[model samples]
Target: MLTTSQILKKVKELEIKSKRLTRHLFTGEYHSAFKGRGMSFKEVREYTAGDDIRFIDWNVSARFNHPFSKLFEEERELTMMLLADISASSLFGTVLARKKDMVTEIGAVLGFSAISNNDKVGSVLFSEDIEKYIPPKKGRDHGLYIVRELLTREGKKKGTDISRALRYLNNTTRQKCIVFVLSDFLDPGFADALRVAGKKHDVIGIKVYDPMDMQLPDAGVLEIEDAESGQVARIDTSDYLVRKAHQDAFFRHSEWCKQVFTRAGCDLLHISTKEDYVKVLQKFFIGRT
Candidate 1:
């Protein structure tokens, strides 16, 4: 647990870092990647030389006895929701930071990027249940609040229930939104809910993981404990077959997750605690463009 002052300092650091990253790297990509609802009619005005003839309002022109052009504006404001998993599994990491910490940083960056693009930023923190939901709102203060919450939040339940989180998001929001689901994806049974949510909204899956989670290091005998469920097991990492099985299991799980998102017609990004997530995110943004 972090003290209030410590938390505040970390929050401030994240704010600065997020804002800087948003301004320098993400603003344009973020703005272009996700589109708003649609164009809306703003007003009617006399047709100009460069105005599109398609926009010429025939009825208005006939009424006013002139060439009137309908002016439309892109409904540029978007709602970006971050569904973050804060389960006990997120606390385990062998690299630079825990999965939870990386998720918080990434969430902060996304929030700041959304706010920079004049979009509403919100978050749903979940474990086995919804830990907290901050309704979508605009402004820097709101983004900061989200960063702080992401930093200090502790899960009430040890396990992950992504389906519950998705269902909550689907029922609560009436409008379509850009939803980023961040998790290590240790749990199962969320494919249906994810597909349903994807059909209605722009869904992106961010799998934050540790390198150790992918494969076991040759450390001879080791004791492993399940973070979500307090189950423990002893295994010989030095055994070739044991290591191969562990690696194969990890690969199967990762492949399964990819298939789930792919079938849902959603994009998924895999990031590890040892790698630069910013680069991964940048690649994703550019790829979308």
Candidate 2:
């Protein structure tokens, strides 16, 4: 737990760093990747050579005896929601910052990006259940508040329930939003809710993990514990078969997660604790462009 002053200082640091990224790194990429809401109907005009025939107003064309087309303008404002997982598993990291820290930084960056572009930003922090819900709001202070919450908030529950979080998001928000779910993704049974949410919103999955999560260090026999379940077991890392099996299982689970996101029509990004996430995020944005 962090003290009030410590939390405030950390929040300020993240706010400044995120703002810098928002200005130089994400400002344009974020805007281009996530367009404004679908075009809104405007006035109708006589059809031009370049206009699509499908949009022709049949009734108006019949009355005027000329082809007419409907025009539309893009809605400027958008809503962005961050769904962060604060489960016990996120507390384990072997290199760099922990998974939770990475998630918080990424969430702050997204919030700053949204607010910088004059969009409403909100968040739902969850573990086994929703821990806190911040209503969508615009302005710098709201963004700062979100950063503070991300830094100080702790998960009360042990396990992760991504399905519950998705269902809550679906029930709470009606309008289309750019939803970003950040987690280690060490949970199960979320595909259905993810698919449903994807149908309504632009869902993106950001999976942050450590190298140790996939491979075990050759430290001979060691005791390993499950962070969420509190189950402890001893594993002989010196044994080649045990290491191979652990690696294989981790790889299999990672692939399965990718498929789930793909089936739900969501974009997925995997970042390791040892890597530079800023570059990864920049690459993702550029790819979207």
For model 1, the superposed segments whose C-alpha errors exceed 4 Å read 59-66
How many pairs of residues collide in each model? 0, 0
Per-model TM-score on C-alpha atoms: 0.96, 0.89
In candidate 2, what residue range of length 10 has the lowest lDDT sum?
34-43
Q: Name the best candidate (by lDDT).
A: 1
lDDT of 2 at 231: 99
CA RMSD of all predictions: 1.4, 3.7
- The number of clashing residue pairs in model 1 is 0
Candidate 2 versus the native: TM-score? Answer: 0.89
- Per-residue alpha-carbon lDDT of candidate 2 for residues 1-289, written as tens digits (9 for 90 to 100): 7888999899999999999998999999998899997789888999999998888989999999999998888886999999999989988888888999999999999999999999999999999989999999999999999998888888999899999999999999999999999998999799999999999999999999999988998999999899999999999999999999999998898899999999999999998888888999899988998
